[model samples]
Structures are given as structure tokens and as C-alpha cells.
Target: MTSPTDPAARQLLAQGRLEVEGRLVDASNVTLYCALELDGLSGHAVYKPVSGERPLWDFPHGTLAGREVATYLLSEASGLGSVPPTALREGPLGVGMVQLWVDTTDDELVDVRPPAEVPDGWRVVLHAHDRLGEPAVLTHADHPGVRDLAILDIIANNTDRKGGHVLAGTDGRVYGVDHGICLHSEPKLRTVLWGWIGEPLPSDAVEKLRALPEKIYGSLGEELSAHLNGVEIGAVVERAEKLLSTGVFPEPGDDWRAIPWPLF
Candidate 1:
């Protein structure tokens, strides 16, 4: 079967040593933070190998995709669906590896520690936030940032946008993560932003989508296109145009709507 732990796993193992350092995440898949050796290079990062054994606890549905899911979400956020990261060459144990990377330059929202404890052992992850902060009030109807997220979710076919998934960076920008169960052939879209349903879409939001096709294709299109089919991309464009034409909050069909759960 084509699993996330397929060729990549073999490649990773061949390039590095696998020392299971125990569980890092006890959610759906029981992610084990492991030490790996990439040739002579080595570092510590979360390793989620696939197994048939199911967890006893009830994790939210579609939580088991692990790093594959994380990678997809990162692609959506960067506007590039498959941007590559600096490969970790095995050097030493307990350092030089970070599996799920937000921006290496920005303060990430997925770090799992108390604030005072600076993220260490991994260089890129040093800036990550252990916990996601509060959501800003949706102050205006013409917020381009919010609209960008809406378009992003639509393209990715996201089913969940838990408040926790909406990361408020220490910097004044917003970031989103966690996209394991997205971009499927199915229409499993679900989100908690129903209040905007049927509301008038802001004119600015429409303009943004109009320009996005030509604008984003130069940089973001290449990566995303690698993962999504042409029909999917066309669908994204079609929905974006429809949203633009309406110039109002849309009462989208079940396939296009969002899930009703908040991560907080």
C-alpha cells in the first residue's frame, strides 16, 4: 500500500539512524519523537510510523495523517503546496532536526512547552510557540487576511479549522497548520464560520481572488500543482470566481462549507 511511511521511510532510515526516544504526541497515531542519523548527520524529530493498531482513546476523526498532513498544510499557508526544507544530514543525537516546521524565521504556534522555556535542541524550531494564542476579533467586512484564509481552506478542501489550528504568531500575522485530511477527492469541507453565511461579500475580497490566478501562479502554483490535479485547480478557480461574483457571505453547499468545530 502507498503509505506515508513508504519510500520516504526507507530513505530516511537509510540516511539516518532511528532511535525511538518515546512518544511525543499521544493523539491519533502516537507520534514517537526519534533521533535519526542522515549519513553522518543526525538530529531529533518526531517520527510517526504507520501501524494497524488503533488507539484506545478517541481522537478527533482524521487525526492520523501525521507529518504528511502537516506538510500539506504548510504548503497551503506558503501558497506553495510542496516547498522543500533543508534536508537534515545526520550529525549527532538530540539536535539538528525538526519534522514539522512553520516558518523558520517566524515564531511558530505549534511548539509544545511553557513560554519561558525557549525551544532548543532543534535550530529551526527554536522560535516556535508552545501554545497558540487568542484569535483576533473579525473587526471588518473587508479583511483581506481572513478572506485569504477562506480561499485557502476552499482550495485545500479543509474540513476542520479548530481555533487552535489558527495560530496567532507573536508577530502580528496569522498562520494555520494541520491539514492531514484535506485536498481529498471528496467534499468534506466543514468549519465553524457559519455566521458569515449569506452575508454580503466585501468587494475587496472579490478583487483579491480575481487577481490571484495570475498573481499566485508564479510562486505558489508550481508546488500546489504538483500535488493537486488539473481538475482540482480548475475547481478552485471556479469557486473563487463564484465567490467573487456574489460579493457577499456565501451559503455554500455542504461540499464547500466548513466544519463546525473550534480548536479552543
Candidate 2:
């Protein structure tokens, strides 16, 4: 199978024939690895149906697919382009989200090392002990792309930013996925990218935050309203405003668990 061009991929995701090839095992919710065909073009995509969503105490039931699309819209509007093109469409399972699959064949691991052994240029988030009771530290590469991801997570109010969610594309760019639990009305920003907490927001990130409110009210807000409630949309705008006002990365709060379970 050949990779589709950007425009063709977008068209396929938005309006294509989704054929479920198999299930992605061990996911918290039902996820399918599928083939998307449109106008003789074929490519791979991930499908997650609303009917398959597991109930969550914190989020409204069956809204995960919408949130996934919302994140893609927000990414495009914010000009971050870190999220892959995604759309809400009807698949074999039902109305679900279909996102163009990212190529991870050449991806590299974001290394985790003990604090004492960590090399230069790696940012440490916290210290802990391994299963064998040896000291270990959670770390991510201190790069601009990772920093951009940290900013994106903050704006999205992502509550499940696991380390595995960060992917490095073969094109030498980083991407984020699995945004079903993001953009909550409450402050639920749990993530592993706390490398720059309490630091000034990069100028580009700050500029994006300042312009996000405007972007939201336009097409992005309209698209999100279909999946998110008024309160949640308001909260998203509020979060953007707050970030712009503070002009700094936020520290993990003591009140809530700031890390996702099973860190990877």
C-alpha cells in the first residue's frame, strides 16, 4: 500500500471507505487498525467508535470520538500542526473518529535514565525506584518539539498525557495522539512533559496562546461545540486566556494525580 498525499489523506479520512482490518489489543477502549480507501487511494487509519467508549467518571460518556476530532481541529487552528489529520466519520462500527495513521517505523525512544546517570540535555521530571529497587528517573529529551507538546497539552487540559502518546515521525517531527480525555472543563492537566514547569513560555508558544481565543471562536469553536458542552468550550477559552496572562508553564498541582497510570 502507498501513502496518500496530504490533501488525499484528508479527503480519505473525512469521506472514505473504512474497512476494519483488526483490533488494536490491550487498549483501554475499543480501537481498530483499519484501511481507508477513497477514489482508488488507500492508506491506514485508526478508528474509535463512540459506542465502544468506556464510561469515565470525569468525562461525559460517548464523547471521546468528538474529543479526538476536537484536538485535531484545535491543533490546526493553533497552527501547531502537531496532531495528525482526524475526522468524525461513519465506519463499520458506527460513527467514529478516523485519523490518518502516523508512520512510526523509524521512531526512537525518549530515554529514561537514573538521575545520576542522565546525560546532558535530558530534562528530569521526577525520581523513583525501579522494580528491582534501584534508583531511576523519568526524563524526556529537552527539545523544542517536546516543549511545543508541553504547551499543547497545557492548552488542551489533557488528563492522560502518557509517555507513549508522544511519537516521533520518520519526517523528523514529533506528534501527539490519543486525545480522547482532553479539554475538560476542570483543571485536569496531567502529563509527563513537565520538563519546563515554572519556566517562561517560549515566545512562539505564547504568541499561539494569545491568538488561540480568537481562533477558537471561529471554526474551531464551532466544530468543538458539536462534541463538547458550552461549559467545556468556555473552559477551553478560559484556559487559553489564563495561559496568555501567566506567560509561563504551570507546575503540577498537589491536589490531583499529575501522572497517568502505567507511565508508558
Candidate 3:
């Protein structure tokens, strides 16, 4: 299918008819695979309704949709362009978050093989045993897109950065999704992107972090304040400032679990 231009996709996401094509059974939350159409523009999208969110003790109830939109805003603010165009809108299932669905048919897994068989340039995060009892290593590619996404996750304070959430777009770009549990006041970062932890921040990534304050205080902040609490918004700014000062990828703290469960 032909993907719409960025502006067209954003317009459709902002104002379109979300026709539910089917339900994605793999997702933990209620996720609808949908087709968005507006003004002769048509494209596929994922819709997550606020009412369908399972309550989480750590996050406020019925705020996942907002968080999803907030991630898109953060992606735009950082100029990373890793997140698909997303918006909060009223759908057939009531208000929900709508995001452009990425085509991943040409995408490949990050790294799920033993060290001996792994390709060069792949950074292994940890070693594990496969179901067959053979050794396996979870790895990510040493590429700029992946690094940009890692930085984006840090700024968002993402708590659930599972491997599956990182998608390789057909356009050769990496896209990160399912950010409902992000931007919390407390530190809750958990992911598989630790390959670059403690490494000096790339100059471009550092510049993006430095530019974030202006974005946060501008329209992005106003938009997020509607869906997030004062504390959450404050935490976003604080994370940006801290990352800018550190000038490096952070190591996972001993205080919290550093990796997500069901890693894939």
C-alpha cells in the first residue's frame, strides 16, 4: 500500500474516519487495526481507546492514549521522527489514540541468535538459552537510527521498551511504538537498547536534547498538559535537562528492573 505524505498522514490522523479493520490479537491492550480516510486520503492506522486500557497501579487510569500522543509529540520535538504520526481523536469506540501503521514486511529482527552465528556490528545486550537449550544472544544493530531511538526513549522515560515495540519501517527507517507507559515522574526506564549505555552521546543526539526545552515549553507542552499531570510533564523536562548535561547514554540503575518481560 502507498503510504501518504507526512502532512497528509497527520491531517488524516487529526481528522479521519477510523474504520476498524480488525483487532490485533498480539497486543496486551485493546488495539484495533484500522483504516483512516479523510478528504480522499486513505491509510492504515492503529487505534487504542482509553476505555479499553487495563488499569496500571503506577500510571493513572485511562491516560494511555494521551501518553501515546505525547510520545509522538516528543518524537517531533526532538526531530528524531522515529514515531509514526499520531493524534488523540474520537473514534467509533470513543476517544482514543490513532497512529499511522508502519509497513514492516521488509523488516528484520534486531538480533536473536548465538554469538558465534551473529553478524558483525551487532551489539549483544545479554546471553540466554533458547527453547532448544542452545545459547542465544539478544542484540541490536549498531546503527544511527537505533541510537536515535534509544535517545528518544530516554527523553520520554519509557517504561516498556520491548523489542517488538521497535519496528523497522519498509522505508528503511526505525519506528518505535506502544508508548502508553511513558513520561512518568519516577524513573521507570526498561528496554533492550542498552548496547550504547555509557557511550558518549552522538553530537546530533546531544543537539536534539538541548533543543527539547523550547519544544516542551511551546505547543508540545500545552498539548501534553491536557493529557498528562503536572508531575509527568515536569519529569519530561527534567529528563531532557539531565540527558543534556550528562552527554552520554545512561546506565540502568540498580533500583529498578532494567529489561522488560517477554523480551520479544
Candidate 4:
């Protein structure tokens, strides 16, 4: 239910007092759950401090939190609106990524089920066997917001778009989270959103792509300069252009593994 675009929500996230409530133990980096409040506006948030980020062999050290914020910026600029409101700020641990926490529903947007059991209206991304050698299929709901996330992932060059990162919020919004490994200059798009392969880009998606250059050269480009280098920012524009030129959902390439390991 966190609406960061609202004036009050923006003010609360930027100036609210933060109190650590708990920690997400399964997170690779130190992820803290916090309660934030300012002028009676209160909500929960997640804080990931750069000091606690685990070093990755592929990505630059201590830059994950900034990438998270940058990804949110691109998502907003693209009119995807599938990413939660994320910001970079000082927390109890240190400077890090802070995002408004989404209250999710029980709806399972993505799932691995027997091929015959794929739900009606769902899109199947892959057909494979499970650990028990049972026929399984990776499927996701065919929702407009989910498609928005797919387009966002393409432009962001998201390296890890696992099933768990797709959240169906109680507010009837679909959100993509945990964008610490995105917006790279290189081609490392790993995602579970290939269900729309070769299909024409939705009208809304095309319009957003058309308008991206104007926003990119304006405030969006200036803000991203803090997190990404000139080359990386330019790469995003290139990806958008490619996607627009193709006018269709992109196909996975052979150079890298298309789907992330342990899809969920």
C-alpha cells in the first residue's frame, strides 16, 4: 500500500525517523526491516546498508544499494511503475538503499507446477522436469503490471529477476523488488519473464520507450549519474532503442543462461 509518488509518502521516506524492527536472514546482504514515521505518517521499510553487502565477483563492490535506487529511478521514468519506491540514504548501519515495504497478497504470480496444471490465462515460460523427474512448467500470470515489469527488466538489464522478486501487493499493484544487481553496461539479462517472447510490445510500453529519451536527458540522466557511469547509462538508452526497434519482446541469447538458477 506504500504510494511513494504521493507527496506525503515522498516526504515521509526522505525525512522520516527510522527504527530497526528486524532482519531478513535469508538475504545475501544485510537486509533490515524498519518502521518509519514522520508527522504521524508511518509505514514499514527495508534497509540494506552498503557496509553489509557481500562482495560479488561480477559486480563492483559496495555499489549494489546504489544500483537498487537507480533501477527504481528508471522504472519510474519508464512509466513502468512496477518497482516500489526506493531511495538511497543513511540508515542505522550506514548509507544504503531504503525502500517502502509492500504489503503483499497470497496471490502466487509465478510458480513451477506440473505442465498440465498450469493455470488458465497464465503464460508458460519453460517446460522442464523437477528434482523428482516430474514434468514441470515455469508459469506466470498474464497481468499488465507483470508485463510492465518485463519491459522494465529489459531496459534495466536486470541480471537477476527471480520469481521471488515479483510481488503481488494487497493494494492490487504488482511490484518487482530486490534490484541490487541491475543496470549493468554488459549484457547479463537473467529473468523468469520470457513468457511473452517474440510478441509485440504493448502499446503503453512503446509509448514509454518513445518518451524515454526526453526524460533521460533531463532529471533522470542527472540522477542516474550518481550511480552509473556514462557508458552504463548510455547502454540503457541503447537497450531501449533496440527493444523499440524490434517492437517485440526479446528472445534469450545463447551467450548466457537465460533463466536464473533456482528460478524461485
Candidate 5:
């Protein structure tokens, strides 16, 4: 029911307000920086909401129209990405706001922490790091979760699966986020899930993916289509079907594959 034409979306946008150092953040492009508190959650959070727009065109028609649908797809992935934040109806900020609070510290959640917290005035690109070095790399190749993520990214045509986007939790689980660059009509899939190059898809996972095209088209797909072209939507559905049939990565068709070989 959450569609691009939904009337309530406008109402919520007009009323929601958050301030930093007495200056209200911009929400005109459907992007906003706000704090949200959720019941039973660990702490308050600063959230950035994307509404299928330009800056997020790595996946055109994504940030603008099909965000809620993307959230649904992620939720269906078995322990793969962040779940959609609960849309707050009313809270300390005010009323009629659509924002998802980022309060989960679960390692399973992606590492979406805002650049070092400052005194209401801060601007810096967040860097990715691990115990080893600056550009963190995943070494192990046998992870089922990582393999699944690669497949998901391929199907969605995700282009920006930055090292920072993959989060490893204390619970020994991994999660992916920042899918704003997904589901493109063109091939833009770029990722680092080649750890399991030849492994077959687990039967159960394939079954779920096989069933996704119908479910997405039924309700989620309808909601997504309002924000994107039918061709793009069909591409996503087709990619899913291909995965269900092959049970292995299809030939890499995008220019994103094949990084330059080692120079040394």
C-alpha cells in the first residue's frame, strides 16, 4: 500500500522537522537527517531517509519511488541486509513523519554509523576500516551469507557495495546495507562476493527466490512500478528467475566486473 502516489507520504513530509544548531536540515529532495527513538531499542539514532531521487540514481527509480519495496526485498533475504526502520507516526520530533530510526547495534545490521558525531556541525566522508588496515577486505570464502549477498546484489543490479557497506556483527553474522544503488535497468552490479565462486545455491534459498517474482509483482512490485519503468521492474524479476534456474552466478555482463589486473 505504500506507493509513490500515497497521500499520507506528503502529509508526513510536510510536518516532520528536525534541527541541527538551529538550522533545519533540508527535506526538499526527500532526504532528511533526523533523530528517532523506538520502543525496546537500545538508543536514539540519526537517520537519513532516501525517497527515490537523483543522488541515489546509482539505482534509478530507486531512492525516489521503490524504497519501501527494496526494504521488503531485503527483509525477505535470509539474514542479508537491514530491515526497514519502523515508520514513526508520532514522536518527540512532531507528527506525520516517515522516518526509520537507526538504533540497532546488532552486528547483523550494516555499519551505517554517521561520520564521527560533532557538536551539531559536522561534515566528512566516513572511511571504512577493520583491524588489519584502511581498505578492509573479507578473506574467508566459505561464508554462506556472503555468497547469498553476492547473488542478491547481482539480481538487484547494485553498483555501490562499498567495503563499509558490509557489516560484521558480534554475533558472527554479516549484513549488507545502502542499497540505494540497486535495481538498475542497466547492468551496474559491482560487489566482492566472489568468495564462493562455484558453490551451488542452497535449495531452500532458491525456493524462496523463485517465489519472489510473483510476490513482488503482486503488491510490492505494483508499489515499486509507480516509481520505475516496467522494463526495469521486469529486469529485476527476470534476474531473479535466472538465479532460481541456474543456482549459480550467471555470466557477468556488466562493465563493473573485471577490475584491472595487478600491475606488479
Candidate 6:
């Protein structure tokens, strides 16, 4: 099968036959690991049935599957983040989100380590004491893709960018997943990728952000309307514009939580 980033992989995700292999027990909602086949091509994917979603007080308007697909669409349109090939479709359980699975490597991107033992080139995010009274620091690699994902989270208004959601794939790409709690028309952007706060946006990122508003107002807007409300769509454009005007990474807002709990 082709790499999940390829267009063919997206088509396969949108139109495929799935066989559930197991469940991801740690997920708050039902997450099934499945083996999927389409037109003689085979691959693995994660399927989340809408029927299994646990309602949240804050995000009570739509199914989590919609948010997942919407986030993927935004990432695709902006070319800022590496989101897997995701689609909403009928699965073995019911209608849900099906995303091509990424085979990740043992790469440690975001991590908590003893301050003295932190990698030489890693950017430190926070300095705190570990549970055992040991001095630990939160840090991440100064990688271009990781920074792109951080900026993507800002535009998408991602509310839950956990450390574990950042993956280093075997294909030599960085991916951000589990975007069920994103694109809210609110300023709730919790994430672990805040090491570049106050830094100027990369030249390439500035160009992409400038290009995003157009797509979000045109073809991308039509596609996103299926999952996001009009206000939510407008918020995305506004977020991009704000970032472009500022031309720098933002610090966490005081109105909401900054980083996800249990970072890893």
C-alpha cells in the first residue's frame, strides 16, 4: 500500500472494507484497531464509531468523528501539519471516523526528563519537580514538523494536544492525531508544543498562513461545512489572520488550561 500521506491512501480510507482486530483500551471513547482492504490494497486504520462516543459537557453539539475529519481537512488545506488520511464512513459498528494508521518509531519527541539529563538540543518547555521530588523538565525536539503541528493546533483551536498524540512515523514524517476536541469557536488551545513561544513564524509558515484564508473561504469552506458550523469555520479564518498579523507564536491564554494533563 502507498504511504498514508498519498491521495490513494485517502481514497482507500474513504472507501474500504474493515475488520476490527482490537480496541484501544486507553482511549476515552471506543477506538478500534482494524485491518482494512480496498481494491486489493490492504492497510491498518483506527476506527471510532459515533455510537460509542461519550458526550462531553463542553463539546455537546456534534460527534467526535466530525471534529477528527474537520481537523484533517484543515491540515490538508493549509499543508501545515501531518494528519493521517482520515474519512467519515460506515464501519463495522456504525458510522464513524476511519483514519489510516501510522506505524510509528521509537523516537522520543516530547518528553519529561531530569533537567541535567535533557538532550543537548531539545527546547525546554517547563521546569518542575517530578512526583518523587526529583527535578524534571518538559522538553521537545526543535524540529520543523513539530513546530508546524504546534502552529496547526493554534489555527484549529485544538483543545487537547497531548504529548502522546504526537507521533514519529516510520515513513520519516511527524504526525499529530486524536483531534476529536478541536475547532471549537473558543480560545481553548491546550498543547505540549509550546517551546517556540514568542518566536517569529517561519517564512514558509507565514506563506502557508497567508494562503490558508483563501482556501478556507472557498473549496475548503464548502467541504468543512459538512462537519463544522458557520461560526466555527469563521473562527478558523480569524485564527489564521490573527497569527499572520502577529507573525509570532503565541503564549497560552489565561482563560483556559495551557497544557494537557499527564503530558505523556
Across 123-203, the per-residue lDDT of candidate 5 in tens digits comes to: 112245544543532332345655566667767777666544555543454555555556777776665444444457777
Which model, 2 or 3, shows the larger lDDT? 3
Each prediction's whole-model lDDT (CA): 0.45, 0.83, 0.85, 0.89, 0.48, 0.92
Candidate 4: residue pairs that collide: none
lDDT of 3 by residue, 1-264 (tens): 336336678888888888999999988889999988887888899999988888899896338999999888888877764898889999989999999999875555475888798778888888999999999999987877788888888888888988888888877788889999988889999989899878898888778778788877888889888888877888888998998888888999899999898787
lDDT of 1: 0.45
User: Which residues of candidate 2, in runs, are more than 4 Å off?
Assistant: 1-5, 105-109
How well is each residue in 1-264 modelled by candidate 1, as lDDT tens digits?
111223454355436566777774534544556665555544554544435225424223232333244335334444532222213223233222224322223444333344344344211111223235622222112234444555566555566755445544333445455444455435655643333556676555555567756643555455445445555555555655666677665554744534443333
TM-score for all models, in order of appearance: 0.49, 0.94, 0.95, 0.97, 0.59, 0.98
Worst 10 residues of 1 by lDDT: 121-130
Which runs in model 5 stand beyond 4 Å of their true positions?
Answer: 1-34, 38-46, 49-74, 77-141, 170-172, 257-264
> Candidate 2's residue-wise lDDT over 71-156, tens digit each?
88888788653887889988898999888888864544355677788867888898898888889999887877778888888888
Give a tens-digit lDDT track for model 6, residues 68-90: 99999999989998999899999
Residue 173 alpha-carbon offset, candidate 2, angstroms: 1.2
Model 1 residue 190 lDDT score: 60
Q: What TM-score should be assigned to candidate 6?
A: 0.98
Residue runs of model 3 more than 4 Å from their true location after superposition: 1-5
For candidate 3, give the lDDT of residue 241: 91
Number of backbone collisions per candidate, in order? 23, 0, 0, 0, 9, 0
lDDT of 1 at 195: 36
Index of the highest-TM-score prediction: 6
Clashing pairs in 2: none
lDDT ranking from best candidate downward = 6, 4, 3, 2, 5, 1
